[model samples]
Target chain A: MLDVIKSVLAAFFGVQSEANRQRDFQAASPWMFIVVGIALAAVFVLIVAGVAWLAAQ
Target chain B: MKRFALTGICFLLLAALMAGSTYAASINTSTGWNMPPGVTDVSREVYSLHMTIFWICVAISVVVFGAMFWSLFAYRKSKGAKSAHFHENTTVEVIWTAIPLVILIVMAVPATATLKKMYDTSNAEIDILVTGYQWRWRYEYLGEDVSFFSNMSTPRDQIQGLEEKGDNYLVEVDEPMVVPLGKKVRILLTANDVIHAWWVPDLAVKKDAIPGFINESWFLVNEPGIYRGQCAELCGRDHGFMPIEVKAVPQEEYDAWLASRRDAAVAEAAGADREWTMDELMERGAGVYNTYCAACHQPEGQGLPPVFPALAGVGMSVDPEQRAEHIAMVAYGKTGTAMPAFGDTLSPAEVASVITYERNAWGNDTGDMVQPSEIRDLLGK
Candidate 1:
């Protein structure tokens, strides 16, 4: 489970390799990657929001 | 190790930047890094659009690079971090692609609308025919007999470091293309000789002036001021010399100027037939030569040597027999050379005056008076 999260995090930074991709695909279920992807995207939006808020100040 | 060093260096730089300067430099000032939302609706829109994209890119870089640096610093080998190897899944790929799609959709909507408005040149109140020559511009107002060739008015002395340069140097012209404020002016662009692009960033109008083809663009002036631009293409040797100056004025003033311009044209036509004195011929010829010929032969009649023959006292035109040949050369520009034929371009009187000026001004005293009638005969008019 931790491996899935780390792999998804690396992919979020857009530096994932084919080997990591194959490992993630061969995992028991696909739900872990989806959940982590959404989580990372949400983090992205939140970072954008926080920076925008600070800039507005 | 490399990534660790990069993140460390980035943080150090950021720290130095934040701690170093209380005087934060601003972008996009009059002489700075930003576009002026000029005093026109279209230009304002362009500026807004440009700023929106600029900020968006800035925001993106900040977020992406911030997260990257954070991860790099936190996951360094020195920090006892071990590399984890895991790759992409189908669901994550789809979401990543879709997120970018959403952002693009948001941007494309307004961008398309602005582009469509810019392309629509319909229902303009005035039409100005802008023809680009080799290194000059000719503006002819449609449905008006007011037309003139605009040339670079900056003297060569300043350009060659012989005199002090003025504030508006190189950007000034003998005649400016005048238009009225709050009126949509459609510019029909074409080229007389080669391809040139008329570009004025403040007005947000740029179109190619291509030979044998017409391109169209339009702009409505919202304020009264002088806006300048240049031929934004490589046309010839003197491409940098040609500049476009647009003077926007109130409607009433524009009408008065138009009337005066028409009157001036009539007065010039009347004077064409008037018998001119040696002094008058010399003066008029100087003006004509400086406009057309001086670029090659030079202002002082001392041509640029072998390429452009010297017309000074001791040059070929000083000889009695070469006088007729000089007239023919000016009238029918020598082929296989850079000398442009002015027979079709210059009026009969203009050709006569210029020849008279050249022969007399430099004291190349053949004392030869070639009448306008003589030039007309050679032109077979």
Candidate 2:
């Protein structure tokens, strides 16, 4: 589980290690990676909206 | 080593030649490669926002590329460097991700604030209706009897390499839209035909004049000077010709100019019915043709055929037998055709001169001198 989280975080930064990526592919389900990717994208959009809202206030 | 030295010398000579050509080319980089911080508070804020983002991008690229280049050069295989077996670093990944998010938020916060300020077109002192036509701009000052059509005043001779071009050239117009300085001028933009954008770079205001939709933009000019702009959107063939010029003046002076303009308009309207001689009609017609007719029908009347027919030696206007048809085409316009009706857009005198000019000028030599009364009779006005 820790490895899965670390791999996702590495992917988010666009600097994932090949060894970590291969390990994640072997140990984790593809569904898990897809869900995490979508969640991270949503968080990014939400952060921008929240920041803009706060600044507007 | 000797061959490399000769090649380097050759490269240096080529570089010097290229630099000499660059010096010959006149590139006006007086204000650097960025938008100007205009003479207004909002414009200044926008400039600050632009500079802030630019610097942030520059800083990020420097650090990112610096690390990459440093690593590539320092740990090259030629230098007997070995690859590391590291998989991932939790701390480094977190730092990179968090830093970018924070930087984005920092940029967005100020940009959102500036945008909101720009969008607040509420308490404007002056309201003006700016309507975009196919190739001209019409300005109607709300709550004032002040309205006029602004058209390109560039002569065909200059455009066709027959005469020397002026400094303003296509950037100049017959009438400039004037506003009072230090006042928020609310411009409600709409298009009579296709979509066109009204943009003034110095003012940092660009809004679409869309058909059947009113878009609003406001600008407060602190300085008293002329600001020129163009139809930023591609409306049609003559889109490049439709230039905008706004003169911001003191309130008292603006009022005086307004009064004088209204008086002049009234005088022009009264004089519309007067008779014009061959010389007068020919001169007026040339201007009218250049302004209205020249875009589709070429300046020399050698039009783009298979679409726009030539009016120089050909067309029904050149023939005396088809004179009524020519007048009808000008007054009512052709149905299902690009030729727009000028009956309402132009005064009777204007129509008369344009018709007279098309016939006599451009080697047609019909020598037809027409009166406004004749055009008025044709229009049944």
Candidate 3:
């Protein structure tokens, strides 16, 4: 079970890692996904709030 | 590097799309979108706020796009560059988030202040009730004895490109909303039937006139000029044809115009008692019908199918009693129908003339001339 989880994680991250290898660059870290997701979610929330406020006006 | 290039391409494509869609006449437009006369302080503030935001957007776009393009070219993959391995810098993420938050805060403060000012409509100098119909605007100046309907003056021939376009072209109107300059004019907007938006970009105000609901806006123009706008909302097929033109004249001129209109209305009322010759009425009535009724009922009294019922062979035109009802419907539009009451839009003479024309046109001669006095009586009742 542990091995399967590791493989799944590797598959998700390793595809982009392989692409990076072909380009002779460092693989994108998993933390980048978390950071980007947080940023995008923040932007989406702000946009929705702004739109709602304007509609109320 | 590839991602940056893709973003750059996407931005360029979006810019081209936006540039392609803007109206040709709006380009090199010197005067701000026509501002109606008698704009209030709030409207002027809103206009200034809009310009401020627009300039801010332009500045942001220039900075952001400039940096993006510079970065793309400076650190492109074509230069055989190796990607930086350093990632997950907590400080950098915090900085980016903090900067954007600060920028939003800066933008929100003034916008909120302007918005708060816009909502206050108390102590208005002049109160005008504006009612939006299917494709026209009606105005009633409370306590001013000034009420009228404003319709698009652009000829169908010009609109259909059947004739040469005039100077104002689509922006002209048969009757414009006239207001005194340098006075705070308050407008209470409502709709007779469907939803229509009263928007004048120069005043930087657009509010939906919803049926059974009143929305308020105010404006005061510093200069006197003819300001034009269109029905911003899509109401129906003739939506594009409904235009709004406001003639803001000096206070003295406005007063004189108002007096003349009142006198003409009184004279028309008195003329109803006198017997009018059919030849005179028909000639006068034709012009009246063409201006007020032709937009929907049509020039030939053949209305548009599936919506506007035909007035030519209709029972309302043939029978005398039904003719009165037709006049009533035209004077005070029937509820739940496209027929708007012309009571507010047309003068007594104009209404009488149009009704007389409708009764006589298309082989349906009722041999009756609807006098302005009758309409005035009907309106009073």
Cα lDDT listed for each candidate: 0.82, 0.83, 0.73
- What's each prediction's TM-score? 0.76, 0.78, 0.71
The 10-residue segment with the lowest total lDDT in model 2 chain A:
A20-29
Model 3, C-alpha of B74: deviation from truth (Å): 3.8
- DockQ of each model against the real complex? 0.10, 0.34, 0.04
User: Worst lDDT window (10 residues) for model 3 chain B?
Assistant: B29-38
Task: Give the i-RMS of model 2 in Å.
Answer: 3.2
lDDT of 2 by residue, B312-333 (tens): 8887867888777888889988
Deviation of model 3 at B318, angstroms: 4.6
Can you tell me the DockQ of model 3?
0.04
lDDT of 3 at B28: 31
For model 3, residues B124-223, the per-residue Cα lDDT tens digits are: 8889898887677888889977777777888779977999999888777777888888887789999977999987765556888999999998777777
What C-alpha RMSD separates each model from the true structure? 9.9, 6.3, 9.5
lDDT of 2 at B165: 99
Pairs that clash in candidate 3? B38-B219, B38-B220, B39-B219, B39-B220, B39-B221, B40-B219, B40-B220, B330-B342, B333-B341
Residue-level lDDT for B35 in candidate 3: 33
Specify the highest-lDDT model's number: 2
